[model samples]
Every structure is written in structure tokens, then in C-alpha cells.
Target: MPRTILILNGHPDPSGKGLCHALGEAYAEGARTAGHEVRRLDVASLDFDFLRSQAAFESEAPPPTIIAAQADVLWANHLVVIFPLWLGDMPAMLKAFFEQVLRPGFAFSYRPRGFPVMHLKGRSARIIVTMGMPALVYRWYYQAHGLKNLARNVLGFVGFAPVRDTIVGSVATRGRESIGRVLEKVRELGRRAV
Candidate 1:
């Protein structure tokens, strides 16, 4: 059966000639070609307050758009993220989105004894991360993926297992061909995804 795929463009830097956006487009185009319904949410273009103020969290009066975004996440069978690795992590806006949207009752829960509970599962996820540094050096030096552990580990704890990741290393120095190669790989992944 056909599936619904949600794409999140987390790059805060807006560039008409950016390689990251191209990667996202390539993945979306490939997913569409493979007969999956695709929905995209570009964080940079969204007009919502990113700050998690006390009123924003406790007042039950979040912006209408945030409410809508939560709905979209729940409706998808696949989740894909296209973003740059700024300072070894996602943009602050995207991270803030997680803080706001991935609320306790929504994305996860807790056991009676203070154990963890998961609410999102039965859906696959993919993250296409671009970095200015080489993956090996970054991994060795940083001793980490330079990515969000929550998206894969925390979310994976609940039900989003097998969260696939695509790392576009050396973005700051990659050539046109290198970028194309990464895009091609992403496209192939999208095509083969169930």
C-alpha cells in the first residue's frame, strides 16, 4: 500500500543555491515518484514563535500553526528530516520545534514507576544531515554523531524504530559532484523505502 511521508527541512539558513535544500527536493521528488504521499514542513518558512514560554506551554494556547504541525506528524507513516549540522546539531528553531511539539502526552509518556513510555511507533524515519566537517574526524573528535539523540534514541524508544540516517559529510568543502552523489543516494533510499 502507498504510504504518507513527512519531510522536515530544518536548515535555518535560507539559500537559493543551497545544497541541503536540493537534497531535500531530491528525496521528496524520489518519494513522490515511488508513489508515496509527501508533505513538507520547512522550519525557516514557518511563522510561529519558537520560544517555549511559560504561557505558551501551560496556557493551552499555542499558535494555530503549531497545533496543525502536530496533526501532520501524527498522520504520517514516514518522517524525513533535511537539515545542516550547525555546531554539530540541528538548528535552534528545529530543536525548539521538538521542545514544543514533542510534548509528553503527544510524542511520549511515562510508566507508573517512572519508566519511559512511547507513543509514536509503526512508522519509519530518515534524517539527511549535512555537515561542514568530515564524518570520521567529527565522529572521532566529537565522539558523537553530532546529531540529536532524541529523534533516534528517545523517539526510537517509543516506536520509531530503525530510524535511518544519511550523513552528508564535508559540506563546507564538497564539490558539485559530491553533492549530487549524496542527493542520488538519498533519492535511491526514498525510492526503495516501504
Candidate 2:
């Protein structure tokens, strides 16, 4: 079935010419080829304040970029986030993007008794994380902490269900062939629209 997909490149680098960015493009290509409507949000290109102050969150109106991003999130049935793990976690810019865009009332609302009401329901997400360490090490030793944080805590909390992830590691030492293989895998995932 055709679906609306949003690919977010969360790399902090403004150039958008790295492994993460390539993976995002590959995914977008496959998704488009599969007849899905695709939109991309390059975090580094957005002109907005990353630091969210108490007043900002309390403010009724958020920045225009954030509002626009929220609209995109609402438009997409599937969200694909491609980012590099820096210092065993996501880049600060990516974190800031979530902090600014996934605001209260937009992504969620508090409930009197139970958990907060998730507004971004009926959506699925895929997180593709690139790291310098071996993939097995990150999965076993670190227990995929970063992936769990985003998949469960952030996206799942907001009602993105069946959240899936792909971990690509040893990126720094990977050759062209290895990178090509990874890109192909990501493209296949996109083709499935999963």
C-alpha cells in the first residue's frame, strides 16, 4: 500500500554529505520508487534555536520551523530517522530537534490518572543508527541503550508503535563495499515502507 513517509536526517553536519545522509537518501529513493509520497527534514538545515528554555516550552506559540516539523510528522504515516551515534548517543542537534518539535499538546497531552495521551498515533517509525564501534558490541555490551531510548522512550511514548531499528556500526572503518551493502539494506527497508 502507498504511504506517506518522512525521512529525517539527524546528522549535525550542515553539509549533509556523510554516511547517515547517504543512508537517508537511499531510503528515500527506494520509498519513492515504491510509490510512497516522501518528505525529508534535514535538521542541520533548519534555522531554529536548539536550546529550549522553560519560557519557550511554556509559550503557546513555537518557532515556525518547529511548527512546520510538527505538520510533517502529522502528515507522515511512517517516520525514518537516520543519524550517527556520537559519544554513545544521538547528536545534540538531533536531541534538540526532538525537544523543540515534539512539544507538549502537539506530540502528547497529560492525563489525570494514567500515562500522557499520545497524539502521534497511527504512525510507525524506523531508526537507523550509525556508530564507530562494532555493531555486536553496541548491541551486547551497551545493550543498544541509545536505540532503546529513542524507540521506546521518545517515539513510543508519543504513540509510534511497532517501532523498529537498524544499527550500522564500525562505520569509520567500513570500506566502499560494506557501505554499499548497508545502503542497499536501507533501501530495501524503504521499499517495504516499513
Q: Could you give candidate 1's per-residue lDDT for residues 1-194 as a string of tens digits? A: 67888888888765534877787788888888998888888777766776657556544555677778888889998888777877777778887776677766777776778757778878888877878788776667886554547455545765786787777788878778887788888888777763
Badly placed stretches (over 4 Å) of model 2 are: none
Report, for every candidate in turn, its global Cα lDDT versus the true structure: 0.75, 0.91
lDDT assessment of candidate 2: 0.91
Which lDDT tens digits does candidate 2 get at residues 1-194? 99999999999899979998899999999999999999999999988775547767655587798889999999999999989998888998898898887878889987889999999999999999999999999999999998899999999999998899999999999999999999999999999999
Best candidate according to TM-score:
2
When summed lDDT is taken over every stretch of 10 residues in candidate 1, the lowest stretch is: 145-154
**lDDT (Cα, 0-100) at 3 in candidate 1:** 81
lDDT of 2 at 31: 93
Model 2 RMSD vs true structure: 1.1
